[model samples]
Target: EPEVTQTPSHQVTQMGQEVILRCVPISNHLYFYWYRQILGQKVEFLVSFYNNEISEKSEIFDDQFSVERPDGSNFTLKIRSTKLEDSAMYFCASSVTSGEAFFGQGTRLTVV
Candidate 1:
């Protein structure tokens, strides 16, 4: 089955550098979302995008973060400045609707 895939499943970054996490969502899906889990916390929605523009974004998605569909098969999340608190598991997800969502294994971001 086609599913979301993320690269550099694990990443360790400096506190103030930039990082880009990559994902390839299922080919047929139309909506994409990004969520983060802070260690043992519940998953929090960061943003959702469709038609090449943001549809919804949580407060967590601030000026430092951005997302894009750089190509037909790839989606990317970029953080302009990393922070120690940014350490978390970032999950890329796709949904046909609110009821049919699928998730990637996740990229563990470790900012030290």
Candidate 2:
């Protein structure tokens, strides 16, 4: 089965630095999303992309954060300025429509 893959399964960065998390969603899926889990907290949606544009975004996706699908096979999330509070596990997910999302293993970002 096709699955989403994220690179650099784990990353460590300094506060105020920038970080980019990469992912490749299932080829046939239409909806792509970025979600994060901050330590013990529940998974939270950050943004959703479809048709090469942002379709939805949460309050957390402020100016400091951005997402892109640079190519059909690659999706990425960039944090311009990493904060200690930004440390979390980021998940990439895809769905054919708006239902039944498939997720990547996740990339854990640790800010020091």
Candidate 3:
């Protein structure tokens, strides 16, 4: 079985700076997503992509946030200006069907 992989398992950045979190979803999966968990909070959906375009996004996914498939294999999430509130465990997930998703170990982003 294949799984999702994320880079820089942990990241620390200054507030008001830019950060790009990277991930490689299962090749056969058709849907990709970005989600974040603020410590003790529930997992929050940020965005979902399909067929190379964003299919859905949450209010938390503001203009400061963006996602791209880039070359079609690597999926990435870019935060234009980091905020303290953005600090959390960011997860990259993918699924053959939207019903079940496989998540990466996650990137722990700490914004100072």
Candidate 4:
């Protein structure tokens, strides 16, 4: 089965630095989203994108985070000015609708 794939499965960065996480969602899916889990806690929704524009975003997705569809197959998340609290397993998901999304294994971000 097709699945979302994220690169650099693990990343280590310094606080206040910037990092960009890359993802390639399922080919046929239209809606894309970014969600994060803090040390195995409940997954929190960050942002969603459709038709190349942001459809909805949670308050947690403030100025520090951004989502982009730079091409037909690539979806990306960029975090500027990283914070210690930002360390987590970031997942990329996609689906026909928001109801049942398929998630990637996730990229683990660690801030030092």
Q: Tens digits of per-residue lDDT for model 1 on 46-88?
A: 9998989999999999999999999878989999999899999
Q: Which stretches of candidate 3 lie over 4 Å from their true place?
A: none
Instruction: Report per-prediction Cα RMSD to one decimal.
Output: 0.7, 0.6, 0.6, 0.9
Locate the minimum summed-lDDT window of 10 residues in model 2. 92-101
Model 2 C-alpha lDDT per residue in residues 64-100, reported as the tens digit of each score: 9999989789999999999999999999999998779
lDDT, candidate 3, 51-111, per-residue tens: 9999999999999999999987899999999999999999999999967999999999999
In model 4, the runs with Cα more than 4 Å from the true position are none
Model 2 ranges off by over 4 Å: none
lDDT of 4 at 90: 96
Q: Estimate each model's TM-score.
A: 0.97, 0.98, 0.98, 0.96
What order do you get sorting by lDDT, best first? 3, 2, 4, 1
The TM-score measured for candidate 3 stands at 0.98
Tell me how candidate 3 scores on lDDT.
0.97
Q: Write the per-residue lDDT of candidate 4 for residues 1-112, one digit (tens) a residue.
A: 8989998799999999999999999999999999999995999999999999999999999999999999899999999999999999999999987589999999999999
Per-prediction tally of clashes: 0, 0, 0, 0
Identify the leading candidate in terms of lDDT: 3
